[model samples]
Target: MKISRLEAGFNYAVLSLFTISALLPLVGVVLSALTPRAEATGGLAIPSSLAWSNFKAAWAEGHFTVYMRSSVIVTVAVVALTVALASAAGYGFARLDFPGSTPLFFLLLIGLMLPAEAFIIPLYYNLRGMGLTNTYWGLIAPQVAQSLAFGTFWMRNNFKQFPTSIIEAARLDGASEWRLMWQVALPALRPAVLTMCLLLGMWTWNEFLIPLVMVTDESLRTAPLGMAFFQGRRSTDYALLAAGGMIVAAPVVIAYAFAQKHFVRGMLGGASR
Candidate 1:
């Protein structure tokens, strides 16, 4: 059904208004970052001269080189492990039948409903007992477990909706289950997988509370956690605080830009199904 011209115009107008509302803070942050410290009045205003040095100052003061390195290591490891394990689990849940499968899957879903705060204290003690605290593994392990529930849910739905004809044809050709899953089914699910990766990467990258409670090693802080500390020290310096915020946010923004096509496609496809 074609929309009326007036309806189309109204839709466009609403979207534009929402888009601008979302972007205003980002635009303000950018302007604040560029404004020289002396000229910054803790409010949005165009800078007379770009204070590019603020980024440099924030970088050094925040020791973001170390923080970013830690964030990358944790995020990459968590996403890779979560995706791989979740894909296998999702495939099994979607395609296989076995004893306790239904009950086990329901148990797994409990992870999704629980908030991080619910178990963080107990989780810290458990990790500490295992000598994992204040280490990269401490940070990486919890995030992986936390992500797996949603990751499994996401992939299981996608896999369930996969075309059965292709699976049957592969089986007729004497393909093993592993071959069918890794070679045939996964390729068709690339968009969904990429979408999961982009989301998990962002979550892992921006995780602050997990890092805060899991590790006290200054060298082990992630970008967001580091930015928190950076903010505390630079509370009075609006320009530097804005610059530091951008530094922490830049990676997620860049990743989303690159993967937006796959992300949008995956979301739309999921919605359609």
Candidate 2:
């Protein structure tokens, strides 16, 4: 079957419209970041002379080096732990039959529906009691738990759609369960795993409430939280604000640029499955 020319044209037009809509604000922000502070009316005006120094100013004054370091540590830890733990649990739920499996999986799904806001207060008290507050663990542990919920769900769906024939063949060839999972199924599901990593990376990097509630140390602030403070101090300076915002956003954008192919494949394949 083929789309008619009129329909194809209409689809393209709609996509183009949506693309422009998405890009317009980003364009405005980029232009604003580049414009001199005095001339930054914040309405998408092209700068006569680029204010590249705004980024340098924001970086030093906002203490972004410290913030970015903390962000990287937390994000990396969350993604690594979530991916490893979630993949194992997802495989167990999807492939192995056990007592209480259905109910247990449902309980895990509860994490997906509940927002951090619902338990943040009690969570803070709990972490404080454990003496984990204002530490890197304070930031990392909760995020791992949150990311795991979604990561497990994502990987389980992918695993469930895996070919049973391959598993059977591997079993007959004396492949242990561990070997089969680590060597065979996981490799085949690279795209899905990568997609999970990218999604979790973005979420962890942008997480504000968890860090805000968990840590008081200025050094422990993540990029987004740091940007909030930066914004407060430079509220009147649009150029600096935009530059700071871009600095915080750059890592996720760079990650996506590198992993976009795998991300797209995983999404489309998961949908199809």
Candidate 3:
């Protein structure tokens, strides 16, 4: 059951190599962001002085304030809706029996295989017709639908793994189905819910194609789409580009850093169940 010293050393070496490979680009980006515009020749090098001004310049030029607000609003809305709807659907499929539950779950699973590209054209027209396009709902609605399939599947498995005795006790105490779902079941599935929310939030935040297609107004452009525009305009300005990139990526990184414990637990729990 124990790994030999040589094998352990080999594994450590392999992991270290992968770690460094992953970190090297990030290191280059951070260094580039700090370098002066003139000095950043698109090559990674320690700058003579850290130029915090690059971020300021990028912020103003990219209109990141507006873009970040859009992204946050869309992300939060999608995540909130996805988590709420998915948890309910998941618990129903896992615990409540219905005539078509199996078929319905399979139908939902079909969504996971559907590429956004397939339905984007119809979706855009549909949203436009509904007067949702160029608004936050235009951005939020599709992502919630896209994320729900996986979220439902994730929560269903986790809910299925919950202790039966606990639910029975709650039922004995006259807990209504709504009370059981909100108070007992959901609280017990916090880690799984949190994990799904984080994943969904990241997806919604980073979504480019949907927002790009749905919103023509610059104000509605999410961070990623705005970053793309900034990158195109400032392709030669590596420092500003790097700064913009960092600004766009920082939120998801910060969120993950804070909630990684729950994220890991949720993934493990879902996998085990």
Candidate 4:
């Protein structure tokens, strides 16, 4: 379908407006990061000096290395566990017929409906009892539980879309259940897996409330939690804050940039019907 010249122009204008609106803060934050402490953008004028040192200071002050390490630990653990458990759950739900399986699956879906805030009090008590609070396992356990709901839902849908014929053929060839899942089915679910990892990574990395509520030890804080602490220390230091914001954002942005194609495809592509 060929759009008219006027229509195309109007669409382009609308696109430009939306794009700018979305990115305006990002632009401001980047520019603000580069601006000097002495020169306030009182107006959005070109900065007389670029304070690239703000990035370095934010790093040292925020103890970014520690936070980054903690964040990576939590994110990697969460993604690995979620994919494994959810994949198993998805496959069972899709391919197996057991008593009350349907109802059990819906119980998992109920997780998607309830807000995380609703479970915080009870979850905290559980973690506290386990003596996991302020520890990596403490942070990881809650994330895994919260994630299982959506992860299982996503993988169930993904599994439902897979061809049953392949699974049957694998079984005919004497492939064990584990082998079939690991060697055959899992490979085909690459796009969905990638999408889930990217999504989960971003979510866990940016998570603030969970860390805030669970972690009291300064050393155990993730980047976002640490960023909040950094923000409080330098309340008037806008440039440093912006620089720190950019630091916290950079890794996830880079991950998405590399996975953009798979991410987009997985969002729209269903299992082959």
Candidate whose TM-score is highest: 3
- For model 4, the superposed segments whose C-alpha errors exceed 4 Å read 41-43, 270-273
The true-versus-predicted C-alpha distance at residue 114 of model 3, in Å, is 0.7
lDDT of 2: 0.92
Work out the TM-score per prediction.
0.96, 0.96, 0.97, 0.95
* Per-residue lDDT of model 3, residues 1-273, tens digit only: 999999999999999999999999999999999999989987879999999999999999999999999998999899999998998998899989889999999999999999999999999999999999999989988999999999899988888898888889999999987788889888877888889888998888888999989998999999999999999999899999999999999999999999999999887874332
Candidate 1 segments exceeding 4 Å error: 270-273
* Alpha-carbon RMSD of each model: 1.7, 1.7, 1.5, 1.6
Q: Residue 213 of candidate 4: its Cα lDDT?
A: 90
Please write out the lDDT profile of model 1 over residues 146-184, one tens digit for every residue: 999999999999989898888899999999888887998
Model 2 lDDT at residue 105: 94
User: What's the lDDT for residue 126 in model 4?
Assistant: 88
Point out the worst 10-residue segment of candidate 1 by lDDT: 264-273
The better candidate by lDDT, 2 or 4, is 2
TM-score of 1: 0.96
Worst 10 residues of 4 by lDDT: 38-47
Which regions of candidate 3 are displaced past 4 Å? 270-273
Q: Clashing residue pairs in candidate 2, if any?
A: none
Span of ten consecutive residues with least summed lDDT in model 2: 264-273
